[model samples]
Target: MTKEQQAQLSQQGVEALDKLLKETVENRVLPATYFGVTGPEGELYYSCAGEKVFGKPEAGQVDPETTVQLFSMTKFVTSLAALQLVEQGKIAVDDPSVIEKHLPELWAQSIITGWTDDGEPQLVPRKNPLTLRHLLTHTSGLGYAFLRPDVLERYEKKEGLKGFLEANIGVEGYVRPLLFEPGTHYAYGTGVDWAGILVMRLTGQTLDEYFHEHIFGPLGIGKEEITFLPTEQVKERLQSMAARTSATKGHIILHPGWRNVAKMTPEMIGLQSGGAGMVGTLRAYLKFLAGILKCQQPGGIISPQTFELVFSDQMPEGKQPRKDLADFLEFMGVTDKQQTEGKVTHSLGLCYLANGSDDGPLPGSARWSGVAKTHYFVDPKAGIAAICGTNIMEEVPTQFLEVYSKFQRTVYDNLVQSKL
Candidate 1:
């Protein structure tokens, strides 16, 4: 395509994305929503629609600057932090001794075999050692109790431990028994949380301190733009979390769980969860993603060789997605049918889409989403990164996925495929 044609396509793409955002808010699929795209140099597109608080027009308008809880999206940042240490020769991806020495609690976790006759969890010692690769790849056998009822739920309930969200104690809340043996199966759980703890143990700095000095500083991101604890001012720009009451009727209400979380003072939370505890503006996150995109070239945030590892498929044979993860992906409506059939694999930091979709991101792209339906993808081959941000507690509403998938298609159709 000629330069003029490319520019025209880009403009049309922006209009389509803007229309999608407005329609979702108007239709009440989400209270507020924003989408952004970035290239190696800087942001290419950004637009947001709807109010910060639904049905409260005077509250504020949602924009690129609005902060939203990043949830699992925080994992990408934490994974990068750990990878930096690895680059410095402070840690190794496949080495287990480093984790064993630093985070012994993780190393000591036993695999749950089966439940006893009386609802007790039967535990067995792990045959293989736990490695940082396992942690980053979600093959460490750790899982969230709420997601895995058979093992982790029974174990946490029997042990009288609080869930990560309910517990004031930080990483301790995530310390649970393994759902399976290490490096054997994929279970989306607290492995990144443990990896964050490992980073702290190795560096002797709090996760926040480490990030400010290393990750954010080098990327030229302001400390205020992204943080584990949002200040009162930062909180003011936060989009209110909403739940879809009726997708068909276009009804929504403030998400009660998120409302309680919004009420939490910084001091109320004890430790920074690397997996879920992050709040940031879309602009700041786009910069972070842009940095990852730049890493595909030389002398970026991380080495080119290291960046290759980030996209490389980390899963070996027999290490497939667990039932819980498969079910969750099905709910999200992003995965290909073949993904559940064992084609799914994880990269160092994100889910690897091996077979590029017809209407979405290309193959070899790494993608993941936050709990509140905040989604992002970094496509190195396409030389672009994009995010679809929303603050909603309902697990991947159908309408939201429709817009999300369409947004991806629009991005590629105009911004990427046009150039090709």
Candidate 2:
């Protein structure tokens, strides 16, 4: 991007941040907010909380560099790590049978023939086998407690996802029955957590070790640069963390399922949550995310061929729509169209791509939200990507899309008006 264009993007980003902070303070969103937008080369905007609600900042205002816990955002990172393996020819996206050898416990049961999980209603037999593509895109039918409490409770009754996975991959190696058949539905569970452990077993590297060696180290992300502040550091970032979130509303706040289990020992929580447990500044994430955006647009890290391999829809050739949303936004950031008619509820991943149907536009926007309020979108047609992160979780809409969408409209109008 030209320096002049870069300045415009930066100006718009700061302006949007200011507006977002205002909304949060007026009780429109949450108390604190961290947001940013970046291209492969430069950050358009890098910002932090407007003010403190839980306490006061020890220093000046919070820096956008302060780390915020990345909930499901870790899924994208996990996917990237898996992609790296694919690049090395270590794994095949089309083979679910690989789980048979490395994840035999997954095959020990009847393979979840019936259905009780909300994410997977049918629980049909494996649809042409549950390939690596199925797991990465959330079609593996692995259920989580996030949306469906009852189903998660049953899985928990089975000693929770972390335990089930550890038992299977760890010493005992016993696989849990699928709540539904593979490739049948879209449910957000610890499936990638299972993937992270798969990385551990296949490479003999724990999730942390693998991420550090392959991902964090190469990317220049370090202990101080990226943090899921342990108890000790919590006090240091506590004020900001507390400021960034609101009280848990009517549900399990963050669902640290591994909290009581062996996999989530304090140290392990920081290490293995390759699926959910990450903390970093928006700028740091911008670097990681920008690479993904470019790679997805087939411009940054991976080749265009590898991009298609990892993100192309993986449903069985003649399979019916298992997801209500159209495409997995897959780290494209958020989209300008989500609040518009374009927000696809059923997708292969985090993106929406104008699926031409009367069902409307549930398929055109690249969108992903952290289990918490951290949400991202990048609309290729719309020209840029934006991410907003806060530790808060709420049942009611915080009106983030409302403000975000308005900003997009403002920019588009301003640009158009200037042309006139």
Candidate 3:
């Protein structure tokens, strides 16, 4: 089809997406939402609707350029940095002892079996040495406190462990022992954050600086467009994030306290969290995704060989997020019965979920999301990328997932219709 014809057809399908977004806001599913889809042949469409902050008229409407905290989505970039190092021969993912070269403290790491009857934290020797691959696959024993209550208690009771969220991601912060042996299972944790520290040690550059000099700068994204530290002007464009809460009477209510968790203060100025700690606009992040999708060809940031590693699965055979973990997530309302019933896996840098139907994206299509309700997916075989964002503090509630799923399905339906 002609380029003009392609654009016309894509626009037609976007109209359905546009209507769905409008209706979602009208129903108060979320205070605001921004989404973009770029694809198979470079077509693009995006929209923003509803108030920027729930019940805060002074905050104004969300726009295409507004920045939101990336939260866990930062993992993709951190993995990208490590993969680039692997591509350059500076690091090897398969080496079990690789992380020790940068962070020696891990050499003596132990696994937490549980507490003793006397109330002492019980520990055991690690069976297998930790590897860079283990960290990338989340098979390395690390975990987050929000998800692991044991870790939260450990962090709180540990002496001199202030700034747990703000600035404690150094050798001192690597205090938690392994939940299990390395490479045995998957638990989302600070493996990527340590990977970020490794990147800084290997390159002698900060994570933010390395991203700009290598990935963002090469793709024409302004240095200031996406950052861990937002300047005054960029800060103005940051939408206030809210935690989803039960409705008051008949109205949807949101708690804004979660916004503080994402803030970067002076104390945290130097700490770069590979697992979380990133902020960017939907437009800028989409550009990053486009670069990831395009870099497989010549003249891109990394060579095709390296790009393949990014999208391909790195998990060991039959090893993925533990079923019990999924059960706990379902209990906490983080995932539904359908999602927990199926296996959860991860690629080098993204989450590997099920394939779309015969008419949708390819079987290997990969995606991941941030804590504050931001999500993105790239279909390599179909040459399509779509992302949706909101500043809401937690995972999309089950009811909202219905809307998000519909939006995703609509995007694919439009892609198929355009082909016809």
Instruction: Indicate the worst ten consecutive residues by lDDT in candidate 2.
Output: 411-420
Candidate 1, run of 10 with poorest lDDT: 1-10
Candidate 1: stretches off by over 4 Å: 1-9, 245-250, 319-328, 338-341, 416-420
lDDT by residue for model 3 over 227-343, one digit each (tens)? 876666677777776665544433455565433533555355547777777778878888788777777587787888877776676676553454544554455454434346645
Ranking by lDDT: 1, 3, 2
Candidate 2 Cα misplacement greater than 4 A, ranges? 1-13, 26-28, 52-61, 111-128, 158-176, 227-235, 238-271, 296-300, 309-323, 326-349, 352-365, 380-383, 407-420
Top candidate when judged by lDDT against the true structure: 1
Ranking by TM-score: 1, 3, 2
- Using all chains and alpha carbons, the TM-scores for the candidates as numbered come to 0.92, 0.73, 0.89
Q: List clashing residue pairs in candidate 3.
A: none
| Model 2, span 196-220: residue lDDT tens | 6667778887665676677667666
Please report, in order, the local distance difference test score of every candidate based on alpha carbons: 0.79, 0.52, 0.71
- Of 2 and 3, the candidate ahead on TM-score is 3
